[model samples]
Target: MVRATLGESSTSASVLCRSDKINWQARNKPTIYPKNFDLTDAERIGHPKQTNNGIYFGIRMGTVYGRLADIHNATFEYLRPQGGAEEPWRIGDFRGYNQAARITPIASELSTEIQCQAEQAFACRIVHNTNNNGGINLDEILTFMRQSGMDTFSLANAYPCLMLTRKGGTTHAVRALKCWDTRDVTPLYHNGAWHERYYIGMERGTLGDAAQLLPTTNGSWPLTVSVFLAGVLAGDHFDLHNWCLTNDGNPAWVLPQAIGLYDACGKSATYTVFDDSPSGGNESIWRVYVASLTQISTGIRFVINSNRNTSSTTYQLFVDVAGCGSNSKTFTMPQYSSTNLDFTWNELRMGPPAPAAGSTYNIRMQIHSMSGTSATTLWWEGQKTITIQ
Candidate 1:
């Protein structure tokens, strides 16, 4: 029988071979040492074995583990196959994952199923041309959406306010309910931004609508309509129309020019009279014609033209118009006959009597000689009217 005994030294191993009468001690048994090896060499030696619930590699220092267990704290260095360079890599470099969860896909890599899933998740429709080499066109996508019943203009009317962002990070906000094409076939530039040849619809009631005055048939009604002017410049004029109710509860349009005027000269009549009589005559000689009057919130306006008669002659004018409290004014005749005296008055106190709309009143002017010794003739002309808004 042969017997073999091993030594305890780490650097060397001593094997004692004994058989029958022959005894021998083999000292300094060579020990296998670990050395830096290339991946090809390691693989040749049957590395990357499953051990302790982990993929481990027997390297120069110790075993290296991947995933399966304690991967969070593992660090490793990899050699470039052709570059002949080593790069240190750690589990943290890959965010503690063995593989990437997401990866950018090329155009050819996008599958039909993935595209459909993306469309369903994002609520967006995409248009692509596999035959063409050009990139995606946003304008074409918008056209597709519009054709598919997702009209951008109508969207504003339905949602009132909506914001949409495109794939290229371009964003658009719905500002109006209607969209109009521009007269110029090209796009328009507004506020430093270029826009397509379409105008966003204005908010309802901003430009006024006759339908706003109509009463609702059911449910709560909106009593007021608001107008908003966004970024409007000065001197911008807006034409408005007046909607009036007809006898049959229908709306009637009144043109701006068709409205009746009630200015000083409007709807006014003038009268001229020559009074040649001796002084001391208290009776009024000429009565000015009364103008066709209408409802007036403010006091009335009058224009009087009178020739300057002989000096020392006093002329008294009385405004005996209806709806105006009794008021009298006196003035002395001018010395020169060529000089005419013009008088105007706006009565603020004793507010004019409130009159119903379309109602008529009479406004008259009378002139009398207070005192004059010689025979003096007075030529007087007067007009009366009121201003309408």
Candidate 2:
């Protein structure tokens, strides 16, 4: 029987007729050689395959990975790309995408604000940089705060003074409950930065609310002695209201049974209480208002005048200390009450008393009228001026 034989280092077999060559070598094959009939078919195929042996000849996922951008821009299998020169394969650099950073890194920020009457709010921010590409979003963004290793923010968990320590330098720790929740997110754009914000609010975490009032040298803020001293050692900073701001005046009519009644229908009113108790009189009040003035004076004085008078009247006057009373001093308007046309330049003066100086009153002007009686109405008419003397 005749059988096919392969050369194996291999010695050759002689043949009287033509024979077909089949390459069967599995190893140690040269990649480039001359094309000639003298070589075996296996050797010829190896050299031909080597000349065209790049990714273009044959492609598999194990060898080359084609991208969607490349396929999207592809034209035909056997020509230049679909986009011509401009449309290169968008596998990588072809799409013009920056490889520096696909997703921007996020930075955090925190700030504090003092509202009216020592209220407080802390603001937090998450910033995304576009590398100066300049883009903005006007949509309201409310991001809940995320911090590692701390209590989660909630409506019932807005702690004001939970942690007032330092984060670094003057930066206080951002542990406010408002910053932790979605309740305080602020959606605002400013200075061309892309960012989202969160807020932390506390009612009483400010220095003024938490710390005791310490007397300060400048005293610009507190402006009182109690702000400097604590406990029961000193008086209140605002309790005195001035020095003190109060006043009381009493006018006693000596007619034990005298009653003044006037009515179209004869409705009457009576006052006989001052008859038995002449010291007890009709009390009138006046208030002395002071604003931001705290200077002390030596003493207070009183000066008054009248242009004309009709009837006679006598009364006693006295000063009031704080809310307490003082003894009365009597006086009479004899010259001024001579007639209804008593238009004389008669003036009465009192006070500047006791060489007492440098006293500050909190808030009142008090006068006590001990005794007086009149059958008709009395009027003191003049161009009057009263001032601190």
| Best model number under TM-score | 1
Model 1 lDDT per residue over 218-318, tens place = 32322211111111111122112111112222223211111010101011122322222226752212121111223334544342322121234566655
- Candidate 2 global CA lDDT score: 0.22
lDDT of 1: 0.24
| lDDT by candidate, in order shown | 0.24, 0.22
lDDT of 2 by residue, 76-143 (tens): 11111222232222221112212121111222323221222222323333333334221111010001
Candidate 1's displacement at residue 30, Å, is: 99
Shift of residue 307 alpha carbon in model 2, Å: 65
**10 residues in a row with least lDDT, candidate 1:** 113-122
What is the Cα-based TM-score of model 1?
0.18
